[model samples]
Target: MKTCLVVDDSGVVRKVARRILEDLSFSVREAADGQAALVCCEEFMPDGILLDWNMPVMEGLEFLLELRKRDGGDVPRVIFCTTNNDIEHIAKAIASGANEYIMKPFDSDILREKLEEVGLIEKVDP
Candidate 1:
């Protein structure tokens, strides 16, 4: 199973996202902030990351920059999940290597669509 790391400061958000990803058959891990997320990444590299923008210790953008600066096998695909909907912020996320952006209060269908768009979700033969 593919692994997904969820990075958010909100317990509720983390719980909901974890449920969603887990139900979709992805192994999920979580962290409360960017700092903790980095530690999780180092320990068990995930195939994708759902990251929040405003986090304690280090923000998502800063974390992305730091990851980009490193040389590794394969940089995990990242989806920015946040309340920040400004076009400039969206542009900045893309510029910083985010594969996709999902606003807060995300709908499950939209999240599923994003996973499919990134080739993370595939149709299963019955």
Candidate 2:
């Protein structure tokens, strides 16, 4: 199963993401902040990451920069998942190496679309 790291300060957000990713057949790992996410990454190389913007300890942008600085071949593709939907914030998240961005309070279909966009899901036979 593909592994996914979910980094968010909110426990509910983490649980929701974990459930969604697991439903898509991904093995989900969770962190409350960027610091914990880094540790999780070192321990296990995840195929993808879902990061939150406003977190305690280390924020999402800082985490992305740190991940880039590390010399590792198995760097996970990242998606910034947060409530912040400002144009500038979106640009910054993409600039910081996020492959995609997801607005919060997303429905199941939206979440599935994100997974498909990242090649984690395939289209079903009609």
Candidate 3:
């Protein structure tokens, strides 16, 4: 199964995302913040990452920059999932190497769509 890391400060968000990702056929893992996420990545690089902004210890942007610098880091399809929906934030995320972006309060369909757009999952008919 494809592996994914869900990085978020909120337990509820992590749990929800975990279920959604699992339903999409990914082996899911969780990290409370970017620092913890980096440690997880170092141990084993996941096939994809569902990241959040405004996290403690290290923000999503910072973590993405650092991750891109690491060996094999470029392989993960990173999708930034956050409440920051402004053009600046979205542009910054894409420029920093995120494959796609998802707004907060997203559903399984939205997540699946973004994952497909990013090439992490195959497209499916509704």
Candidate 4:
């Protein structure tokens, strides 16, 4: 099964994302912040990442920049899952190497769609 890392400060958000990713057949892991996430990645790179924009220890944007600098970091399909819906933040995320973006309060369908759009999962008919 493919693996995914869900990075968020909120336990509730992480739990919800874990459920969605599990339903999609992904082996999911959780990190409370970007610092922890980086450590996870160093140990083993996941196939994808569901990253939140804001968090303690390190923000998503900074983490993204650092991740991209690491060898093989470019391979993981990164999806920025956050409440920031502004064009500027979206543009920054895309430019920083995120494969896709999903707003907060997402359900399984929305998560699946973003995963599919990133080519991490196959497109399925509704």
Candidate 5:
């Protein structure tokens, strides 16, 4: 199964994302912040990452920059999951190497669609 890391400060957000990712057949891992997520990546690179914008320790953009610098880091499909919906934030995320972006309060379908859009998953029947 493909592996996914869900990085968020909120336990509830992490739990919800874990469930959706699990349903999509991804082996999921959770991290409370970008620093922790980076540590997790160092141990074993995941196939994809669902990252939040704001958190303690390191922020998502900083982590993305650092992650892209590592060997094999370019391979993971990164999707920024956050409440930041402004064009500037979205543009920055895309430019920083995120494969896609999803707003907060996402449901399984929205998450699944974003994954599909990024070519991380095959299309599923309704």
Candidate 6:
């Protein structure tokens, strides 16, 4: 199964995302902040990352920059999942090397679609 790291400060968001990711057949891991997510990546680099924009220590963009510099970091399909919907933020994310972006208040379908778009998951006949 493909691995995924879900980085969000909110416990509720993490829990919801975990359920959705697992349902999609990914082996999921969770981190409450970008700092922790980096540590997790050090031990096990996942195939994809669902990252939040704001956190207590280390925002998503900062982590993305750092992660991209690390060895094997470029392998993961990084998707910025955030409440920031502005064009500036979107452009910044793409410029920083994110494969895709998803706004908050997302559901399983949205998440699945983004994952598929990034080629992290394959589509099935429905």
Q: lDDT scores for all predictions?
A: 0.87, 0.86, 0.95, 0.95, 0.95, 0.96
In the range 1-126, model 3's lDDT, one tens digit per residue, is 999999999999999999999998999999999999999999999999999999999999999999999999999999999999999999999999999999999999899999999888899976
Instruction: Flag regions of model 5 displaced more than 4 Å.
Output: none
Lowest summed lDDT window (length 10), candidate 2? 68-77
Evaluate model 1: give its TM-score. 0.92
Q: Give every collision pair in model 3.
A: none
Q: Compose the digit string of candidate 6's lDDT tens values, residues 1-126.
A: 999999999999999999999999999999999999999999999999999999989999999999999999999999999999999999999999999999999999999999999999898658
State candidate 4's TM-score: 0.98
Those runs of model 4 whose alpha carbons end farther than 4 Å from true positions after fitting are none
- Give a tens-digit lDDT track for model 2, residues 39-120: 9878887889989999999999898889877766236778899999999999998987888899998767787788778776
Q: What is the alpha-carbon lDDT of model 2 when measured against the actual structure?
A: 0.86
C-alpha lDDT (0 to 100) for residue 76 of candidate 4: 92
Judging by lDDT against the true structure, name the best candidate. Answer: 6
Worst 10 residues of 4 by lDDT: 109-118
Candidate 4 lDDT, 1-126, residue by residue in tens? 999999999999999999889989999999999999999999999999999999999999999999999999998999999999999999999999999998988999889989989999999997
lDDT of 3 at 117: 93
User: For residue 89, what is the lDDT in candidate 2?
Assistant: 97
Clashing pairs in 5: none
Q: How do the residues 1-126 of candidate 1 rate in per-residue lDDT, one tens digit apiece?
A: 999999999999999999899989999999998889888887887888899999989899888777666664146888999999999999999998889999999977778878877778885445
On residues 62-101, what C-alpha lDDT tens digit does candidate 5 reach at each position? 9999999999999999999999999999999999999999
Question: What clash pairs does model 2 have?
Answer: none
> What TM-scores do the predictions have?
0.92, 0.93, 0.98, 0.98, 0.98, 0.98
Give the number of colliding residue pairs in candidate 2: 0
Q: Model 2, 58: alpha-carbon shift in Å?
A: 0.3
Better of 2 and 5 by lDDT: 5
Task: Give the Å error, residue 26, model 2.
Answer: 0.6
Root-mean-square deviation of candidate 6: 0.7
